[model samples]
Target: MAPSELRPVRRRLDAHEPEPEDAEDIEEYPDDGFDGRVRLDPGRRGMVALVGVGVAAVVLAGWFVWRDHPVSQPVPALPVVVTTSEAAEPAVAADLVVSVVGAIARPGLVTVPPGSRIADVLLAGGGALPGTDLLGLNLAQKVSDGDQIVVGAPAPPMSSAGASNAGTSGGGGSGGGDADDSTGKTLSLNDATESDLDALPGVGPVTASSIVAWRDANGPFTSVDQLGEVDGIGPARLEKLRDLVAP
Candidate 1:
């Protein structure tokens, strides 16, 4: 080889730069980070984007429908009640017992109902004797068991019509006639008829008939207290008739 035509040899650099003489044969391109072999067509890319949008729209529409209309829950039921039917018991009546003494007939222990007053006890033990003075006695007081009752003694017999001749009726027992209110004379309970008794202040026809019925059933009146047994004759009525009639 001629010395002029022979070229000097050059060492390869660490950067691996091509030799100046070989640079003309090497092809150059832009610095963009894209592989030419992996490129996609514009039509294929547009179709893929459209498919993804359609799937997202369907998912969003399904979520909205589920939020608007929810599932319905079941309703609770009510409770029932029950009752019982039973019979009631009956009440019983009670009685009282007490001892009685004094001017009353058949003085002894007697049985009476509860809430019996002193007058009731007296009536239970027969009527008091005639002319018996009952002063300062509580005839309306209630009584209980095991009590002693003391009746008032008979007062001395006196005459309302003074200086009048005594008319003896039967066996030393003086019997006065019917009432003569105009003459201030009292009526005799033993002999007075219903009509005679009905003429009094408070005694009506019914009371008069009851008095007669009582006399007929129980014999003659022994004392004014026996009038308490007659119908329609309360303590006030008996008090009104006390001075109007004599037993």
Candidate 2:
């Protein structure tokens, strides 16, 4: 055969030859600027965007719920107010009125305690005048209501010659000793004056007056023990005066 005819025959034979056994399979790809990237469909892209939006909306809703329901704080308690009631005070006891007359700066009626003694009345009367015979009166004795005290001049001291005469002439002696009969023997309760009765133990001026008043009302006491019949003079008091008084 000719060379030209051989070239056309070789071309036909090469075209009919089989491919290599070790050749790699190539996948078809489209060119859109990004290489080695997979392209998604429009519907698939829309599904992914919807899922992202739904997750974001869920996170936003959780944040709003947490904001609306915040943790609570404890409240403080209020202070209490106290109220008090006003009341009036009670009345007190009144003072006792007594008439005080003697040798003093201001001798008249004076208010004193219920159990004022003679010394207290003397002080309330601006004290005794100079040279007033204080020993003649019972300074330790308690005074009563409307009592009149006379402050007399002291008796002149008896001379030793006159003291012997006083012993010889008994009736000629002064009668001032009669007021102090308690210094001697038993006193007669039926004849005793209120001042003499005041010398008895536990027998104040008030009780002495009550005794004289009882004797006047009920006659003379029959027995010395009958002194217990008087008010404020109980068995204990009568027992004290048993050796000191006579019916």
Candidate 3:
């Protein structure tokens, strides 16, 4: 063979021989920490940043969902009441006891209601006798729990003609009814009846009735001067009867 043909064959053989690795493909770097982790290249760091951004977006989406849909809470309750009732008692009234005597039909102790009047007590004792005097008493007045009603007994009724005859005739005459009956006898002021009072010279039946009414309303006259208190009996009439009557 010629020298030119041998040179061509040697060049072809050199072209087939293996070349050295690139610096980027396989690199030797110092350890960044004691754990032996190597520092990453720029391309690897970029890929890690992309992964972190994706995780942050996922966390933000979860937070927005939690804010929109809130959790629920509980409530409370109320209370109650009750009541009861009972019956009440009733009230009672008391009675009044009183004593009655003197000229009443039946004189004794009697019972009446709490607010009874003197008239009621008198009626309970069987009412006043026919000749009993009521002029000195106030029958309409209310009575106390313990009371004694003594109805005064007036002198028996006398005829107007007999009273006048007794007043005009003198004593120690044959026709005189009895030795005790006298012409100049003074009449009793406290016990005289209407007919006995009419025997007075100036006193008529009307005046006698007025005197009895006055004694009933205001009680018995304490003195002869009190006779003037009657409706028709004046000072002159009182003087005329003053010497003839005695209380």
Candidate 4:
């Protein structure tokens, strides 16, 4: 074998020298003098770790407290007030004054409620005498104030003085007064019926009813002249009736 092809002989190492290695076997390494990051000592590192652990524990405790209960704003209260009021009173209707007479239990002046009827007047007069016929009376007719209600019997006859005020001829009206008892022909203004007044010259049924209504409203006539107060009885009409009637 050629000398060049022979294996390189390895030298034995001495105690004072370093061992030699082949160039191909030696490895290239990067420079490693020191790192850019700051390093701490064992004691300092331990203190930093302890401080971090303490900070984390404190943060965790704060999170737990905040999750359980939160802060809230307070609200203000308002005041209440009370009030009182008075009630009003009701109104009452006025009563009417009327005269109830004739065959009733009690015949006299009586006060009744307004818009009362003839039946009410009968009740006010202690009602008509027992068995008294009511078929002749208009119990449903409305009565006014100062009205005279006669029940169960005829009206009383008029006296001479009252007849004189009538200015009427007797049962046989001759348009003038007659002094003789047999044919004196005296007509009582108070007792005279509507037919009697209608018989007077120039007096009609309308005028006669007006007279009766006026009498019913004003009571028995004090004088024949008072008839002038009736409605539709103007000064001219009154003059015509004045001679036809006395009073």
Residue lDDT tens for model 1, 45-151 = 79999899999999999999999997899877767666547656666656766556566787777788978887898899996767766673478977655444556
Give me the candidate number with maximum lDDT: 3
- Per-residue lDDT over 1-247 for candidate 4, one digit per residue giving the tens place of the 0 to 100 score: 7665553332223444677999999997655665555555659888999999999999999999998886896876766665547556667777876666556898787788978888898888899998877765688877665455556543223444545645454446543434233232434567778877655543445666888898888899888678768754544445545645654
Instruction: Provide the overall lDDT of each model, using Cα atoms, as 2-decimal numbers.
Output: 0.67, 0.66, 0.69, 0.65
TM-score of each: 0.28, 0.32, 0.30, 0.32
Q: On residues 1-247, what C-alpha lDDT tens digit does candidate 3 reach at each position? A: 9998899899999999778889888878666575775655659889899889999999999999999997887655655544447555566667876666666888777899977887998899899999777885678867655444556734334443446666655655665664225434566655678877765544555666877887788887678877877766644446656876765
What lDDT tens digits, residue by residue, belong to model 2 across residues 178-238?
A: 4233234566788788877765544656668888988998899889877877765655447
TM-score of 2: 0.32
The lDDT-based order of candidates, best leading, equals 3, 1, 2, 4
After superposition, the stretches of candidate 3 with alpha carbons farther than 4 Å from their true spots are 1-93, 153-247
Q: Total clashing residue pairs per candidate?
A: 0, 0, 0, 7
Task: Report the number of backbone clashes for model 2.
Answer: 0
Single out the weakest 10-residue window by summed lDDT for candidate 1: 154-163
Q: Residue 201: error of model 2 in Å?
A: 13
